[model samples]
Target chain A: MKSIRGLLFTALLTGLIAAVALTGMSVYLRVLHELDVVFDYQLKEVAYAATMAHPDQLLLPLPSDSASYEREARLAVQIWKGDQLVYASNPKRPIPKQRQGLTTLYLDDRQPVMGWRVYTLYSKDKMIQVSQPLEARREVGIGMAWRSVRPLIVAAGFLVVLVLVSVSYGLRGLKRVASDISSRSATSLDPIEEAGLPREVVPLVHRINDLLNHLGHAFDAQHRFIADAAHELRTPLAVIQLQAQFLERNTDEKERAEAHRQLKGGVRRASHMVGQLLALARLEPEMGGSADEHLSLDDEAGEVVFDLKPLAEANGVNLALDTDTAWMIGDPEALRALIYNLVDNAIRYTPAGGTVAVTVRPSGVNALLQVTDTGPGIPPAERERVFERFYRLPGTSAGGSGLGLAIVKSALDKLNGTIALSAGEHGNGLKVTVSLPRAGEEPTEAPESG
Target chain B: MRLLLVEDDRMFGEALQQNLRLDGFTVDWVQTAEDAEVALSTAEYAVMLLDLGLPAKSGFDLLSEIRAQNNPQPIIVITARDARRDRIRGLDYGADDYQVKPFDSDELAARIRAVARRSVGRFSSLLAHGPVTMRHDTHEVTCHGKPVTLTAKEFAILAALMEKPGAILSQASLEDRLYGWGDEVASNAVEVHIHNLRKKLGKEFIRTVRGIGYKIGDNL
Candidate 1:
């Protein structure tokens, strides 16, 4: 490609140079033609004076005066009248047969010869013929042509340099884009928001941004699925551990009973985790084609489970729900997972006798689902990482596999919901607020919901 | 109380049955959802301890079928999965309560009795803890059978404390009970409720476990 561009540029430059040279040369040739006529006329004048000076001097080429005159004038003078042999300088020179007004003639050596311009002077009973060789005038005309073309040659050279410099500079944007895209890490799908220098590059930038958005979402889903799976596997192991412990120290029925109880709790934990994991995996957006995969997550808000207030009360945490019955379009199971996670996380972290209030409200077009807890609030810097899979708060002794918020975030993404973490009422605890699309939208109706 | 236990693990199920019998409850053990269904069809159980991971039919499916037949019997789901979603799911599908695996047998028994008693609509009497007794129906309190004068807020505080014998009740929880949703609660509302409850019920009834929450115990 580079060679092709270079060749094209060279061809254009050569053509332009040739055009200017040809134009200047033609004009110089025309001026030389006019000058040749004037030179021939002077020779005729000389011839006329000689013929008048002596009537019997017809065939008079051996004269030293005429020869010296011709040499001094830089013209080979010849005189021929009425088709007779003419007086010519250095008699070896041939004269034209068709004697008339000035015209070009060719010599035996192929040099151009100028035809004589005659003054017949019939009243004086004599004729005058004058001629000059065209070599000297031809040399001067060729010199003028070269002189006219020198500037054009230089200008064409400068133009080629300018074209090279500007074209390479203009192409730098493409090179920058290539480097930016190639150097990116496999998982970094963040879009490039900076505008390119040229308008022509905008389309490419937009396309890359779109691809990055899709890739980021895909990675998020994958991460959530893995975390959910790990959480699901933990419960059964906990159950096995409890049962083993019970068997190891079975001195009394009370101890065995306690082990059995612990085993049951572990099994429940494992099963619940597995169920949530499966749902999360299934709900993850498929690779590519995400734009059309509109998930109806808003309608699921009405599918409330057993009221959580009793559980909160039993745990000595306050549960206050402020929203009316609202619908969200998303997987009902996933929504339940998100809500349970938020509530569970609140209950676990809140000091006993501390309040955990859950409120669902209408925020603009979307539903605002918030869970506020009177626990120690997450720091601003760490708030973003709390959504990552298996990320638990730093100092809480709460017993959890750490998939709660991860599942919530995964589900929220499917619903195109937004979540924000901020300080709670007293600015002493964490408040997680989420916004989900309103129910009954066409995107929320999943084909498999039935 | 007679309890029916549906579990797939034979050893664990048998052990649980034996232990529950010793804990003053007549226990019936089954290994599959099908057997549990048949037994439940004919027997009367005060509470059903259902394991969700049963063979042949999942415990959830059995519970759904049972609920479809208009059975409102208290069912507590027992599973090894500790995910909050699963517990809510089980409850959403009509299970009464959920308990994770590796739990204490005493705690399980306590939950069952509490659920079973509530299911049987036995909320007319007072719940007595040490010298403090709070009548559920009338929302009245008595100490050593002596009439105890308490405000509505103080009564709620003491009721929350008495409900969970050894468990801690966070100050936030007490305040939530006192105020409804959207009702602005002062920051020190729970402290005030605790102070009022102490003045009426004696200071030792509610123990302040600093940095955690408040707890009530029989020793207090």
Candidate 2:
């Protein structure tokens, strides 16, 4: 992984160096061109100066002294009369004259001098020319250009350092967020602190905090659920233990038989509790995902009633279903569990010769499912509390883990439905009414299939 | 021993009652704290097995009531609430011993006997008089270093007499200890058991009181 500082520094430095180099090149070429123009003007002036001098003086051969040698190395002066060379600044090199204003000619006759820029002026019976080596002109132009561009190279280096430091400073908040998350305990779901966060990273922090909030709630719910399950399992286990003790110590055959029967009953109750707990866990709202299958609530309820008929018969309770074809979009398994819990609860609570009736029918744009039982109903004040997990009403004789209504409520919530418990027919028992939107209606929320 | 059991869970309470009966205890089981309070006020119990989650009033409230009334019936709390704080609270509320649910019924019986013995200013389950030693756990009696096998009724009668040495116990009280509700007893059942016990052990073991019932001689 590339460090943000390194990446930013590299990119900015590359751009700065490219810009400096291009600007330097353009400045050097422009200065060189200007120097050429000035040199040509100076050449014309020197040729004019030579023309103004006496023709005899221009023709005199200059001696090769140190000062004169330096002057001749840079500048070459020549006089031509009638296309014949009368005089030259370097006697070993004869100048070749160009047509007029500015020309370049290689003075290679000396085998060492490379090139020259020459200018000529014409007067009556006198033609004077002045030239300078091209190497000398370039040396002056580039020397001055270097003086102008040296600061830009230095500034580019400084800019790279500044960008690196600033980029690292800007990215410190991201590193802090990473370390904060990494150092946290696995069980800790607390939100990350957002104070003093960079503007670019605040949205990320907010999203992470939101996820932590949800996770914390989910963990808390799981913990509470496990605690409640353990507490609910204790009583039945205690009953089984005591029954086994009774069976072990009793010598009377009748008492032993009774103990054996109670032991079996205790095992059955414990098994039922475990099954209900698993059903409740499976019907959790978060477990549902994209339930798009269309199922009939009437058919689902009929199946649940058929399955629970034996239980109702064993308890001597009359179980009946009066339902029509009512279609709704939901998970078949969850819907079945919902109906089973309600009917099973009703049958378990109702006395012998009592009745438990289930009905499902379409009402307008909604499907209504109801279970009415002739059992001792929950009081109006305690009806809502009964839906809480593992909460059994005091003094009730029905053997239950108290997760039946809770499971029903959770399933209904997942299906985007509503439930209400009120007095049964004739106002003597419990009637649970559930309403769900019919298929093809605008759903409150799409149900997720398990 | 007579014990009062206060528990709301019907199956658990009934099963625990049956086990305690088999352990040679006359258990009066009540389903609510209110009924427990009433029973405690009316009867004498050797110890009480109290469950915390009750219908009307909780066992905690009943424990406070019992302690406030100076009732020292050696209450042993048997509850499903096994949190450390709950156990501390139960003990603080004057419970003599605490047992959590799903506990071994034999262990509970042993603890009951231990607490019952402590209430009577004894520290051991073994009742020794002269050469006779009765082990409560195994219900085995030894006389002169020889094991003596006794019927359950005979053991119950001997245990009742050994509970308070030299204290006169009425025939009705002995009958109460020997039988629970619905157990058919002949009118001379205590006499028949006493006769058999005398024949098996020795005539000098149990002494008959003239107007009272019977007593074990303190003299070895």
Worst 10 residues of 2 chain A by lDDT: A61-70
Q: Tell how far residue A402 is off in model 2, in angstroms.
A: 1.7
Error of 1 at A448 (Å): 25
Candidate 1 CAPRI classification by DockQ = incorrect
Tell me each candidate's TM-score. Answer: 0.40, 0.82
Which tens-of-lDDT digit does each residue in B1-220 have in candidate 2? 7788988888888888878877777888888888887877766778899999886588999999889989788999998888899999999999999999899988999999888888889887788998788988889999898999998788988988988888899999888766655679899999999999998889999989988999997677
How many steric overlaps are in each model, in order? 45, 5
lDDT values, one for every candidate: 0.68, 0.85
- Cα lDDT of model 2 by residue, A1-450, tens digit: 976776787788789878877877888899889988888887887788787787677655533225743353377788889889888876665767767667888767685547888887787887878778888777776677788888988988888887777777877888899999999999999899899889999999999999999999999999989888888899999888888877887889987888889899999999999999988888876665646578889888998999999999999999999998888997777787788889999998899999999999899989999999999988998988889997789888467888999999988877888999999988988999999889853345768889
What is the docking quality class of candidate 2? medium
Candidate number of the best lDDT? 2
